[model samples]
Target: MLIGEVARRSGVSARMLRHYESLGLVVPSGRTVGGYREYAETDIQRIFHVESLRTLGLSLRQIGQVLDDPGFAPSALIGDLIRETERRLAREQELLKRLRAVDASGPTAWEGVLRITELLRGLGSPSAARRQQAVLAAEADVPAPVLAEAALAEADPHVAGALRWALARAGEDVVAALAPGLESPDADVRRRAVQVLADLPGDEAAEALTSALADLDPQVRAHAAIALGARGSAEAVPVLVAMIIDGVNDVDAAEVLGALASDPGRADAIKRALTAELADPAAPGPARLRLVQALAELPGPIALPMLRALVSDEDRTVARTAAALAGVIETQDGV
Candidate 1:
């Protein structure tokens, strides 16, 4: 076949076929009387092969090595191609996300678009200070979704706090954006997400925390319970009691439970829960100690009976700790 027929059948443009010939990638196997390039069947097949490799994201140089070098191994080259394709895909996906965030912001001008883009970059910056700055400048029109995403992924304490603050100020709509992070496989992400939800004021955030109370991660459930208890969600009573028993952030848990117990009904429930845990013979000594200490934070009328009973308990350490706490509770009552 002549080069024209070869180009037509193979879908390779004649100019590209000529370029391939110049690069010695697929030279014509013969020539006509007019001295035009002519291609044999093998030459046309090689053109098809080059096009096939290009679709796999192979560069022209890599294709040349693959087709021309008999000693070339494809395994390493194929791995490199996969990695390059993945990197390109990641970049494209990130760009698409940024564009969507900008569109979600309803930016009306090029400058608004640019500012949103820059703020997103700052939020994702490696520097904690930069991330904090981005969150602080969020009042300048950063979208809530962007702040929510950054807040969920952020590990730095100060930056995470700022991001939560910004998201809360952005609006309650961010609750929807943040709700998914509660189910994240990463426990740290789930914990951070619950913390942000805690700071956000609304029934939406409260509902999210109430749902998170059953999360598989103990830390996540503990954080959720504390947040819920502070908001007067009595559903947290059981988890708060458990936190005291497990000695996980038990202090904060006790404090929040104390606040929740200000209600007469919740106080009665909290008092019973604490005494029930104490009644379990299998409850470990350290747990008993932690429980005794937590009861001190409860109202005097409810805790005094338990403290009085525990002061003469079987365990000496428990007895001493309970005695000391009872004295403190009684002295405070006297005042």
Candidate 2:
């Protein structure tokens, strides 16, 4: 076959076939009397092979090595292709996300588009300061979902706080955007999600935080519990009590529980949960001590009796702390 016939059958353009020949990827096996390039059956097969490799994102140079070098191992090149493909996919996904965010902002003009794009770039910047500035500068123009997504992924405390504030100001619609982060495989991401959800005011945020109560991460559960407790959700009582038992942010957990106890019914429930932990045989001495301190955070009337009862307990440290707390409660009561 001549070059024209080869191009027609193999779907490689004549110009490209000539370029391939120049690179020695697939030289014609013979020549006609007029000195035009002529291809043998084997040459056509090599052209098809080069086209197949191009579909796998192989560069011309890599294809040359693959086809020409008998010693070349394809596994290494395949691995590199995989990595490059992954990176390209990640870039495309990020671009799509940015474009969606911009479109969701409902930009009315090219100026609005440019402004949102700049803000998004700032939010995604490597510098925490720039991200913080972006969040602080964000207003009603920035969509709640955008802020929520940024808040969930933020690592720096200051930047994260700003993003949460922005999300909160953006309104309760952010709950939908933030909900997925609660199920994230990364504990840190789940924690951040709950943290922002805790500050957001709405049933959606509350419901999201309520679900997070059972999160495997202790910190995530603690945050959710505290938030729920503050929102007057009795659901937080058990986890707050557990936080006391585990000595993880037990002080803050106890404070939330004490606030929850302001209601008579809730006060009784909180009292039972605390006393139950204190009475458990598996409860360690240190945990008991923490529980004793947590009990004091309750209303004086509710806590004083428990404190008085604990004063005579077997653990001397628990007794001393309880006795001291009981005395203070008694003096406050003028008993």
Candidate 3:
């Protein structure tokens, strides 16, 4: 077959076939009487081999070595090709994601597009400060969904705070965007989602947070409790009480519980729960101590009786602390 026939049959352009010939990658079996290139069956087979190797991302030079060197082991080359393909795939996926984010933003002008692009770059920057600045500098044109996605993946505390702040201001759009994150199998992502959702206002955000209270991850549940407690939701009472008992962010949990207890009904409930936990003999000594400290935040009517009973207890630290709280309670009560 002639070169033209090979090009037509193999789908390799004539120019590319000529280039391959110039590079000595594929030589025709012979020449016609007119000095035209003539490709035999073996040359066509070699062309297919070159095309197959090219599909694996081999450079022309590498392809030359692969085709010429009998001792060339494809193992190392194949490994490198795999890594290069993976890197290319990653880049393509990232680009696709950015494009999707930009499309979701609905930018009407080049300026909006540029701004969103810059913000996306900043959010992905290596420097936490840049990430923070990106979030702080986010404008109305920046998509809330973009910020919501960034917040879920952010690891730096400051950057995450900034992202949450940005998302919170975006309103319910952000709440909707964050809803999927709550269902993430990753505990950290779920916790981050709850953290952001807690700061968001509206019944939608509240519903999400209320649902998060039942999250399988303890961290997610704790965050939901704190957020709901701060929002004065009585449903948070049990989790807040549990956090106090478990001594995880107990001080902050106690403070939130105290705030929730400002309502007369909640105050009574909080008092009862604390007292119940205190009276459980299976409760460790340290846990009891934490509960005692937590009770000090309650109204004197509820806490004084518990403190008085604890004052003469066998544990001297508990007795001393209880005595001191009782003294303060008595002073406040004008006793």
Best model per TM-score: 2
Root-mean-square deviation of candidate 3: 3.0
C-alpha lDDT of all candidate models, in order = 0.87, 0.90, 0.88
Best-to-worst order by TM-score is 2, 1, 3
TM-score of 2: 0.94
Model 2 pairs whose backbones collide: none
Question: Per-residue CA lDDT of candidate 2, range 1-335, in tens?
Answer: 99888888888899999999898888999999999999998898889889999999998888999988989999999999999999999999999999999899998899989888988999889999999998898766688888888888889999998987788778646888887898899999999999998888888888899999999999999999998998899999999999989989999999999999989989988998988889998889999999999877888989999999988898999999999999988898898
Give TM-scores for every candidate, taking all chains together and pairing residue i with residue i: 0.93, 0.94, 0.84
Model 3 agreement with the true structure over 1-335: per-residue lDDT tens digits:
99889999999999999999999999898999999999999999999999998988899899999989999999998998899889999999999989999898898889888888898899899999998998898896567789888999998999999888788677548888898899998999999999998878888888999999888887899999999998889999988888988888899898898787778978878888888887888988898899889878876777788899998888788899999999999998998
TM-score of 3: 0.84
Compared with the true structure, what per-residue lDDT tens digits does model 1 show for residues 58-145?
A: 8888899998889999999999878988999999999998989999899889988888888888977899998888778765457777
After superposing candidate 3, which stretches have Cα over 4 Å from the reference? 31-38, 124-130, 155-158, 183-188, 215-218, 267-269, 311-316
Separately for all candidates shown, the number of backbone clashes (residues 3 or more apart, or on different chains) is 0, 0, 0
Better of 2 and 3 by lDDT: 2
Q: Model 1, residue 108: displacement in angstroms?
A: 1.7
Report each candidate's C-alpha RMSD, comma-separated, in the order given.
Answer: 1.9, 1.7, 3.0
